[model samples]
Target: MGPELPAALRAAVEALLEGASRKDLARRSAQVSNTYRGGGSSATAIVEDADATAYVLSRLPATYAAVAAALDEVRVAAPDFAPASLLDAGAGPGGASWAALEAWPRIAEARLLDASPVFLETARRLAAAGPAALAGAEMRRGDLTQPGEGWRAADLVVTSYALAEIPSERLEAAVRGLWAACAGVLVIVEPGTPAGTARVLAARELAMREGAMVLAPCAHQQACPLAAPDWCHFAQRLPRGRDHRLAKGADAPFEDEKHAYVALARPDVCRAAPAARVLSPPRAGKPGLEFRLCTPGGIERRFVARRDRAAYAAHRRLRWGDRVEDA
Candidate 1:
């Protein structure tokens, strides 16, 4: 089973679905999916309350699972780091904020910013039934691509699956702005595709140029060694609720959300860079195991033979997203 939704959040979404027509929701969900697939902006696609609710029902679980998984990596990279304030940029239904709060309970203040009023309103409604910190979170409506004055600097800043919507020309500026508002760490997550990987790569370069240190996914600050046709991404499986199934018009009991993300911390923050990160699932054969990893040196394929009991046993425990020191 994947990460379960909190009881209050589950109830809140259920309540929203009570009066909603399944057929209407399914139609809207399809439209939203089509719009996204066609490269349209979600800020414009999700305009109505029903549209926003449909989006949450169909996308929230997977998004939350993805963000939560990424945040887990952040926790591992910076075990002693805790942020009291968080700024969730382009926070659609506040899934990133929810995940951030779960990862760092010390987050006492949260600010959620989005350009869509309906998304902001729905986020507020859903958060009202969640933890106190998130329930009392400040919701602000603004275009993330544009620099604004109302937003405050935070210890942690995160943007999940939001940068893809910004025009390519504005993405650099937006990323810089988010980094400027981050006093400690900045995390950005995007869909697991070539385009998404490209966006993350761009952000990674920008963060490095700003004197930020790599905190996750990458073990070194050197240029990404992966060439074209090979991009970095990870997957998280999440259980699908009845409402989720209905909204998505699918019978599957679970969903796997694949994403590409990077977590960068300011130099002042204490964080240890992993020696390597597993890039693919370890393949076990009669002879031994084959592991594909991204290390400080570059991409490497290591083979551990069955004769090497100690190394083989250790590599057996490794997963695709796991960080290893010497494997």
Candidate 2:
């Protein structure tokens, strides 16, 4: 499992659930999930305050966990990146903003934009119980699919699980606009399905053309190695609170959020690229261990035999999404 929710955020969620109707929340959550799974837009999916609150209770934790994990990889790629400002486009319930604040304490200014007034209002209420930076966050109601002027560029820009909601025809323009608003790094995250991977891949290409460098999940700016039958994604497990379990109608104590994300930074940001990234869990066997790595050399299936004691020992510690210098 990944890191647990920050204390303040957890407390705030718990408080929100205190007076909420579990049954209604569960029903609404299911509806929202179905809508997204069917490629429906969220602009009308979350229509009421209750619907927005349900989304916060049911989906916020997983989204936060996924973004947090992605941000950790960003830190690994650029340790010196201490963003002073953040712009969370499509910041539903402000989950991405909270994750950004947790990842970069230096972030002093935060701007959250979403089209849904109810979501923005709920985000504000949730931010009230979060860190001081979020308590005074600038929440704006705007459509991210359309580019607007006068929005200040931030040191870090994040759009989590938001790109998939955009219409296919306008996605390229949206990606470009987000890149234009990014002064430092821009991270985009989506569901781990093939569709999600497609969005991330498309955005990656646009970012590269816009002069941004790939920072995670790819060792090179070349085409993706995985083909149609396969997609690139990672999973982060997070403990499910009682409210979350009830809202999702799940019996599992924890939920694994599978996500596809791409992190890109300004061309001037100097950082060493990982020789490869472990695409899946290392397989242990009688002979030794095998890993599927996405390397600068291309996709490779490497094996470290038990006879190679030192190499096998180091390989034992490897997990999915790890950056490897060798092998």
State the lDDT at 290 in candidate 1: 89
Evaluated against the true structure, the overall lDDT of model 1 is 0.88
User: What's model 2's lDDT at 173?
Assistant: 86
Model 1: which ten-residue window has the lowest total lDDT?
A: 143-152
Candidate 2 CA-lDDT value? 0.89
CA lDDT of every candidate: 0.88, 0.89
TM-score computed on alpha carbons, candidate 2: 0.97
Off by over 4 Å in 2: none
How many pairs collide in each candidate, listed in order? 0, 0
Q: Write the per-residue lDDT of candidate 2 for residues 1-327, one digit (tens) a residue.
A: 787878998888777777877998999999988887887877767999888888988889899999999999899898888899899899989988988898997789989998888899989989999777799899998888687752569899999999888888999988988999999999999999999999999999988998999999898889898988899999898998787889888899998999999999998776765669999878999999999999998999999999999988888898888889875
Q: In candidate 2, what residue range of length 10 has the lowest lDDT sum? A: 143-152
User: What are the models' TM-scores?
Assistant: 0.97, 0.97
